[model samples]
Target chain A: MVAASSTKSISVTLRVWRQSGPKELGQFKDYSAKDLNPNMSFLEMLDVVNDELTARGEEPIAFAHDCREGICGTCSLTINGKPHGPGKGIATCQTYMRSFHDGDIIVVEPFRAAAFPLIKDLVVDRTSFDKIMQAGGFITARAGSAPEANGLPVPKGDADRAMDAAQCIGCGACVAACKNASAMLFVSAKVGHLGLLPQGQAERDRRVLAMVNTMDEEGFGNCTNQYECSAACPKTISHDFIARLNRDYLSASLRSAFRPEAASTGGGGA
Target chain B: MNLVGSFFRSSIGRKILMAVTGVILIGFVIGHLVGNLQIFSHPDHINGYAQFLHQLGPLLWVARIGLIVAVVVHIWAATVLTLENKAARGSNYGFKHTIQATLASRAMRWTGYIVLAFLIYHLAHFTLGAAQSATFKDNLKSYVLTADYRVAGFPVVNAGTKVADVYSMVILGFQSPIVAVFYIIAVGLLSLHLLHGIDSLFQTLGLRSNKWSGCLRKVAIVFCLAYFVGNLAIPGAVLAGKLSPQSAKISAPAQR
Candidate 1:
């Protein structure tokens, strides 16, 4: 419990998933991580293992990461059977050695989903998210340059909700955490973020429809409302956005069916 | 896109179908429970209720067919969704640990299958009289309608008319301890199913929000518990001899 005790080094055995290629057979490979600082990040522990592996002329583990601070959404390890390791609202890079005991055996694997193909050891293709974003996670309005701060008076409540939803980093933890591998939480975050704003209202219906269509086409499964996605989310996104999505999709589908073809185009600026 | 076409094509749309169908099935469960509770009343009262239902004739068939459709659709949507969810997970994880999933949420498909089996057996035993002829169709009995037999005090026919004794049929049907135990187990599973399914239905339909989520789960627990006890009371009363072909006015919750 003292600061001096926190400085004590720890050792652990890691059972990491290792695959040579996307099509290769992968299995768990055990490595001993010894003399590690309890404050060392999980990725840093992997770096130590890689260093030892390179010295022994063994292939180094291939893991994906960028920002060690957890903002880039680039860290995608499923440590100890959970995305982003043992903590809440933090990415894998943010997971520290102190969370695990000294003699613990940590198992790490990459996120798994039909839509996200595994590329190498501890890295999977997350381009499916990009495709979903391309579908309708944007607006067509050209409000060039910053308008007067008061010109587009968005309600405080709507502005706050939009900001909350916009915090989503699109790391695919929602899918990884879900029993169904559902991307509803991720898709809902994007849809809810934009659909809550004035500029976003111009294509609100189209945005939800197109994003959902793309999400399904990518082969992600349907949500059963178990909310594992929210529990697993690194950004701590709420599943409430999913309810907002269902409402949007329902109204959109109904409106699209009833709207005349000529006026189907949603005029800009609500 | 065409409404019907899009409704079935999209995953969210299919979930909407599931939620809507779930609503119909839950309504039927509540209605069936209420109607069956009348068995505790005077023999003439329950016999009169059954007679009034039989008199419905074509209308009864319509309601029955509608309920069958709801059941079929609910099961079908669940099957499709389960398969799709399994496929989406792609490969099983080597190290598995559930963080926050409830027992009712995890056991949904299993409880659902058992409940489905219970439904089939129930219909065979009581509705069609196919499961046990001695306890059902061959057990001959009748109740003579008195002035009190008038449904809601509305006179329909002669007061002395005799009607088939459904009261005894139910009494004899649950006489076997095996049947009683099976009813208890099945109804218990059904209560568990509703505990999760009803709350999930609200979320799927966009009816559950952060403000209502906690209260919603508590409400579901209370309702499921009461429904389970209501169902448990019937067979419990029968097995304890509180109700028989010749007796009535049993202890209410004590038998349960």
Candidate 2:
């Protein structure tokens, strides 16, 4: 972590949620962060405060973070009712102290969603996403010699759409931001990315069925088109993919209904 | 599981139903507006149209039943999806701000319920003659009768039983300021409902793309506004005294 330069130091107060475990009731605890550098990243400010708490023999605030440049998506925080802070198209770690005023009381809490049970202060278990991914977020290409880069002549439109869907980092900001705690955006991203690719076409029907079933089994809420998920997404993934997912799921199910063997045979890809 | 059963059980499936039913209902709205727009013509134009509909016999009943089924399914699916969404939220935010949602999008459920209530009231007032509000009953009573009204081509005008005089019934119905105001409010809400619904239906059906989204949204807005203006014109004209059948010469032989 970079040290705060003395020239442009600032002061602020953070109202952070503190919880020891998943079963414990979390409450807001105020911490005064003095001499914070406006140029420092949001997480660095927290780090400085945590150092002070440790020196005072207090329990340091715990928050999840990795690859602090915003790609890891491990840093999940709800700042003032917004997922990933106030910055658009960026993760919580990308938020800078300059966005705040001196003495501003910043309220920081973990992502709030039924599917994302709180693990500690500003940390929640997002493994439900992992479980859904494990169900069917892959193609069944064998681990062999690499294929030629341009072996598949995929249409540019499909390729671009696939890439757009591929941008999801499974951060759960979408679930956090949604009113219904729905995972449609996340699920759609996964479903769409695979379904759009040529290699993924073989098992597309089975992939959608398994992934959607897993999503429901994970106890996530239904999507009602409030669209807060896409709005809150750090990656700015479009909600248009959700519609694609819906269309695919419907057609896949109908196809299965008419040809059960197609679904049964395609399950091998999982 | 059966495809239909599984479809209803899934969230996206339910949305598909909402989109499909919404499209069906929109078709009904356009058909209804066109049918009602005939009221702008001479009394014979509208009354003859009503007579022609009545002459459809069993086919009219089938169409009516189909419309009722479409409406019921649309409402039922929308209600279930909304309730499920509410239950999913679990907890409300302490401080919330909507970034991308519009007023029409946010007010979809509220407007939908209002439109549903208006539908019931409209049917009772116009279809079943059960709306006992003084203005509606008075309008029905004072309606200028057409000669030799028949049900299925048989004249059955018993005492206290009135002939079907749709032209005057509609004209006098809107003569009530309260009724006119209610109709305006309902249609306004309907436009709001449609504004979001039309765009969302395209989205739900996966027909929306970056290239077409803006164009489709503009189309939806234009359609909703036009429908609102066209439907509202009936009551507006009635209140403005432009559609008064009594003022028009009834001597002009009622066109068949």
Residue-wise C-alpha lDDT for candidate 1, range B37-149, written one tens digit per residue: 88788667667777777888999999999989888878888998899999999877888977788999999999999999999999998888888777673465566777445
Candidate achieving the largest DockQ: 1
Q: Give all candidates' CA lDDT scores.
A: 0.87, 0.81
How well does candidate 2 reproduce the true complex, by DockQ? 0.51
For the predicted complex of model 1, DockQ is 0.77
lDDT of 2 at B90: 54
Q: What is the iRMS for every candidate structure?
A: 0.9, 1.7
**For model 2 chain A, the run of ten residues with the poorest summed lDDT:** A1-10
Candidate 2: residue pairs that collide: none
lDDT of 1 by residue, A70-116 (tens): 88888898887888898888888888888888899999988989898
Instruction: For candidate 2, give the lDDT of residue A21.
Output: 87
Candidate 2: which docking quality band?
medium
